[model samples]
Target: MDVLSYLATPFTDPLMLVAVALGTLAGVYVGAIPGLTGTMAVSLLVSLTFGWSTNVALAAMIGVYIGAVFGGSRSAILLNIPGAPAAVATGFDGYPLAQKGKAAQALGITTTMSCVGGIFGVLCLAFLTPLVSKISLNFSPVDYFLLGVMGLMMIGALGGGSMVKGLMGACVGVLLGRVGMDNMSGVVRFTFGSTSLMAGVPSVVAMIGLYGFSEALMQLKSRDFTVVKQDVKRIVPQFKEVVKHFWLTLRCSTIGMVVGALPGAGGTVAALLAYDHARRTTKNPEVPFGEGAIEGLVAPESSNNAAVGGAFIPMLTLGVPGDAITAIIMSALIVHGMQPGPLLMQNSKDLFYIVVSLCLIANILLLPFGLTGIRLFAKFVEIPKGRLFPIIVILAVTGAYVTNNLTIHIGWMLLFGFLGYLLKKFKYPASPLVLGIVLGNMLETNMRNGLVAFKGVGGFIGSIFTRPITFILFLVLFYFAVSRMRWWKAMMSKIKGFFKGLFTKKKA
Candidate 1:
């Protein structure tokens, strides 16, 4: 359908527009806070939209989805706190810029890049989902397992300062993810017989604790702090700056979409992966990553926004939830009596198009609101940590508790909170742990499926060598492992050698 036709549809009713605006606004604020997530925003909206039309409800939900993901960069840049899991990578450089008194510029630049990434992802979904979905069909169980291994290794390589700590943290995450039921046997593995344990630890609660509560705890540790000073002039980012970083923005957007399209890989993974890619691909590796590189902000901000669009492709084409936000979206669709599969496309073409169209609209709307909001949001840096941390602690507790309304889940969050803080203290990247948890089930499921397809262990092993994709994935895994081990030493030696050569040349 044409834009004009879509505009004339019932989905474009004033009530729907109002809903979209309100939800988007709410999403930005919720996501700006360090604990509330896009999933939570959508989950909350689900209750309020029972009486609304399907398109209206979807428009509202999508608005929140788009806004919340983009909103995460606000805290990431301003407070050194990642407002959401996806924004974790943003803190690598975002906080540094805040300390440098360029928080406004960083926020504005990140917001613009995020909008570009979101729009690019939507375009990809509009045009390339069929092809992307087809590529996913080629992934065998071995390939998926290898992919998980590679993803985990990438996190290990780039996570904090110590590889061992990062790996341990990642292992902890995998163990936590393994707590509920065995994939093939349907037997409970780690659950100690409590009925609540049967359902397993909630990913949201874990994420809130790891990314949210941990941040609050860390802030509480520092009684004396300096607030980020903002300059309004910097908040209105220059067009030239955007053009200069166009390539980085594009690359991160592609990374986000590709990662997000994968089932179970969400914005958090996408952001971290993009950050790793940015670090590797940059010409000057000396730009101290944790010291506030614009590249850091650009990487996560762009990728997370792009992830939203990437997430919808699987939901629309394969009936799979691309991420937790899309999972909520799937539930919302079911609530509206609209099933979400190939049949939905054939039966409700307009509804599908309406969603795709909303993505485009939401991307456009995010820019002005995002820029204006950042200008005002920089003011929050003035809030004292004593007051701010308490508010953050409450929000974190509330967000974690609401997941299942169980105190045990809150306790699980606290456990992860301490774990996350210690990991951070020891220079371990907590992101790898998150990646492991998200991909662990896929790894196990795919391996079982592939083994069953092969009819035996021998055939399964043989297929690894025979399947070209599987072989390629293995090669990538091997490369990542060896390369990660040598990266730091190699880079340091290279720097040392460069200086020696420069001195030798001068002496000659």
Candidate 2:
């Protein structure tokens, strides 16, 4: 359906509009808060929405989905804290811009670009999903394996200053990922006989430590953050500047949507992949990518929002919950006496229509709410580091403790936090390690499953080579690895030459 057609259908529906507005507002607020996230917000709302009509529930859900993604930029730009994991890269550049007394302008730029990114994602969801879903259906074990490998390559890209540090970090993450019972043998790998370890280290706790606590410590070490009061003028983004990065924004949106559609992947992965993709594609990448790259802000915000739509594609059509949020939606469907999947589409067309309509409407409603909230949200940067760090530490502890309501998880978080601090000191990129931990079990189990399904190692390799998609993915990864190696050598050579030249000049 056309954009106008989509909106016109809902023009007379006051309740739908209300649901949309409320959802968007909730998303923005949930996303702007330091520890609150889009996933948590939607999950929390699932219970509340159970009694509402599908349209109402979905409108609120989708609205929060968009708002939370956008809300992440608030903390990212202002406090150097990403409201959501997707906004991690955004903080790198967004906070830097805020520090430069361009808080209002940065907020304006982020909100505007985020709006564009959201629209871009919505378009992809509306148009490309059918075609892409068909392609994804063809993904085999080898293709998935290659995809996992490529995803890990993001560590190299994200850990820009040091490959050694990045690889070490990734190794740590991989080792962490290897914890818990083996998928094939059912034998516990790294649990050390602890019942909690049997389930494995929670990625959320690791994420909290890696991004939250580690960041809190770093902030504590720095001198007090100078909160500059800037005139909050022209909160709207410059259309011309957005136009300049149109291609980049489009690419990021595509990345977000595609990554989001994947069954288990979420915004954090999409954001990281988009950030790496942007870094690889750009000629002169923004200097402070992790510290603050406007493009980083743009990529993840677009991708995560798009991912929401992408997740729905599978949930509505295939009966698969793509992520934690969709899982809740699936439960909501059960609670409402409507099953989600192919049958739901066929048997309950109106409900399906409402859900799809809500997603599109949520994207539409995001622009105004996001743009208007920029000024107030940007003020988050003004909070003293002293206040922010303690709060972060407390939240980190609470978030970790709440996992099992056990003090052990809190201890685990502290241990990881200390390790994170050490990794930071040594220039190791902790994210790749986290990704490895997250994906390791999947990689191992899937590989073993593929092997068993094929009946042997030879059969697995033969199947991989025979499958076009799998073969292509393998080749792509190979080429990327080689290219990265070459790039690393070139950078090392330049560094060596500069140092050598300086020594020679001194001797003369």
The most accurate candidate by lDDT is 1
lDDT per residue for candidate 2 within 251-279, as digits (tens), equals: 88777777677777656667667777777
In order, how many clashes per candidate?
1, 10
Global lDDT of each candidate = 0.77, 0.72
The TM-score measured for candidate 1 stands at 0.84
Report the CA-based lDDT of candidate 2 relative to the real structure: 0.72
Per-residue alpha-carbon lDDT of candidate 1 for residues 1-508, written as tens digits (9 for 90 to 100): 3645854563447776766676676777778775577777798889988888888898899999998998877766765556677887787688777767777888888878888999999998878888876665566777766766666766654566677777777778888898987767889988888777877776667766776667777768867866545666767667887887789889999989987887776787788778877876676743577787777788888999999999888888888888888999898899889888767657776776677778877888788778776656766665676776666667677767766778888788888888878877876776666666765776778778878987878988888899998887788677666655668669868999999999999999
Show where candidate 1 strays beyond 4 Å.
1-15, 77-81, 159-161, 181-184, 191-198, 212-223, 226-228, 334-339, 343-347, 424-431, 455-457, 485-508
Clashing pairs for model 2 are 27-68, 78-381, 92-290, 92-291, 92-292, 93-291, 93-292, 93-293, 173-433, 256-303
